[model samples]
Target: MELYGLVTLVGVFLLLALEPVLARNPLHHPRLDRWCNNIGLAFTNELIRFFLPLALALVAVDGPWQAFNASSLGLLWGALLAFIIMDFSLYWVHRCSHELRWLWRLHRTHHSDLDMDVTTSFRHHPGEVGLKLVLMSGFIGLLGFTPAHLLTYVLLHRCFALWSHSNIRLPEGLERQLAKVLVTPRVHQIHHSAWQPETDSNYGQILTLWDRLFKTYLSPDQVPCPARFGLEDFRSAEDQRLSALFAQPIR
Candidate 1:
């Protein structure tokens, strides 16, 4: 798990470096301070998870879950089923984080970033990470997903999170077609809009199907173009500081 996590981290950074050179979005202006704060948050989150009991629990139960596999489903079919269940579970978890005020306090940290980029993907609060682990553990245990299935899903989830938050722009036609199935950059950008209505919609992380099925999906055309990013209430530079973000939930 540690090695896989390291590889995913490296891949994310590589994509971060390559995106601007390949297809940059003019709206995003990267800043050193913002990157530092974002990375700091990610480091803090990793530290928190490392010490959490949930991490140890996952390791201990991994082998047992595979050994007593009650599901006679074939490997390929089981993996696909697990992936869909995990994605669906995450959709509700994410949406609840917005609808519930307590969850919103922790989740708001991610939306406070004025500039969206690959680093923005790691800007979540440590509290939010812990909460997600708690929620995900329930789904993983209930669905009886194997360790291999969990690792693959985690890698794919991390990659897509980076891709969705990236500043690279795709051709309009292609982006439109992709949004029909997956959560494209344009679709995710709308979720970061400063406007409350736009921000509340498009809550899916990897698949667009959840939002569409739940009637929470909104296209870029539905809202103003070049939608303003970040929380309107916390737009100051000071609000993005590492210390400030760490204390934001209680504030």
Candidate 2:
């Protein structure tokens, strides 16, 4: 667990610290908004996720021992299985975050950003992270995942998610070819598209197959080119102001 924390902390720090300077595009959100979400909320959510599971899983699980049991599939296979499950779980969670009105209250802060960048990856609300933590706790416990296995899968998917959100777009042919296996920027950018159809499609965060399987997949060529990005209802200026933006009502 200590190493897990270290891995997450170091990875997040490097990405959040140097991505702006490394990427060619200018950082879109103000430094304050970026820090507030990436550093402030990240720390807060980390603490919440850490503690919440201890309590929530106590009565919730059949037994903690059961949760720690090894998968007969072996570590490598267990890791792969965990990765697929986590990605599928997150796909539904993200889709519901958009479709459900109340859930959108906690999730909308992320979309409020008009500018797409790496730091934008951490702009989610603490409430949303809390909900995810609860869901993750249930998922691991019910599925009998050891902490090591779960962390491996979580780290893999999260790294892909951060990479997908990056301002550094991939070479043209690369994204199309890779979308056959991994999630690519072009596929994910469509998820952030301002248009309704594109915005609702492409919910798969790590694997491209989930969207295709579930009928939400829209190829980059097929989705309309959004004239702009961000939530359909959000204005660029007001969305920059963190306090006012989070407090805005969903229309």
Candidate 3:
């Protein structure tokens, strides 16, 4: 578990370190730029506030499949099953985070950045990150998943998320075909759009099925918001961080 955590954290760092090459344009906001100054401060505070509580919750809980004694083959299959189940769970979690008000508060932190890139993936408020960990961890325990299995599932999803954030566009025809299986970059991009219709749609992360099932799916062509990204009211990037962590709009 610790090893997997290290790998995931390192993956985030690698994305941050390679931001220049991976981003579509030069990154619009620096990690410590003037506009994002409050963002970093809030991030540090939220991490301390949330992770400490989350750690205690996880320690008290029993992980899934904690009691099973199985053969090596069984373990492999168990892990595979675990990954699939977790992916489904994450799909719903991501969707709900957008639909619900409180969850949206934390989720907004990640979306505040005008530039949607891999670094944006890690720019989440620590509180939001901690909440997700708790939710995923509980789901893991409830599903009887092993630590190894959880780690594998986490890595796979992280990779998918990074892919979704990439600046590269998918061929329109190809993206439509692939959305039937996994989420394409085009499909996920709609979720990042600052437009009202676009912002509330395309809630899936690794899979597009949930949005389809829930009727939240919107095609890039039909709801084509091919305009500048980011919130309309918050014009300047300076307040992106402030609004993200502490001042959610009363809409």
Per-prediction TM-score, please? Answer: 0.88, 0.81, 0.72
Task: Residues 1-251, candidate 1: write the lDDT tens digits.
Answer: 58657865786778778776865455454478888999999898867655553454455454544443424566777677767877888899999999999999999999999988888898999989987886676556555566655555667887788888888778888988999989987889889888888889999978999999999999865665455788988878788789999999999
Best by TM-score: 1
In terms of lDDT, the poorest run of 10 residues in model 1 is 62-71
> lDDT of each model, Cα atoms only?
0.79, 0.71, 0.63
Q: Name the best candidate (by lDDT).
A: 1
- Candidate 2: misplaced stretches above 4 Å? 1-38, 50-73, 236-238, 245-251
- Looking at model 2, residue 133 earns an lDDT score of 86
User: Any idea how many clashes model 1 has?
Assistant: 0
lDDT of 2 by residue, 26-121 (tens): 554466665554555556666886678656545454565464544667788777787888889988999998899898788877776676766667
For model 2, the local distance difference test gives: 0.71
Scored against the true structure, residue 182 in model 1 reaches a CA lDDT of 91
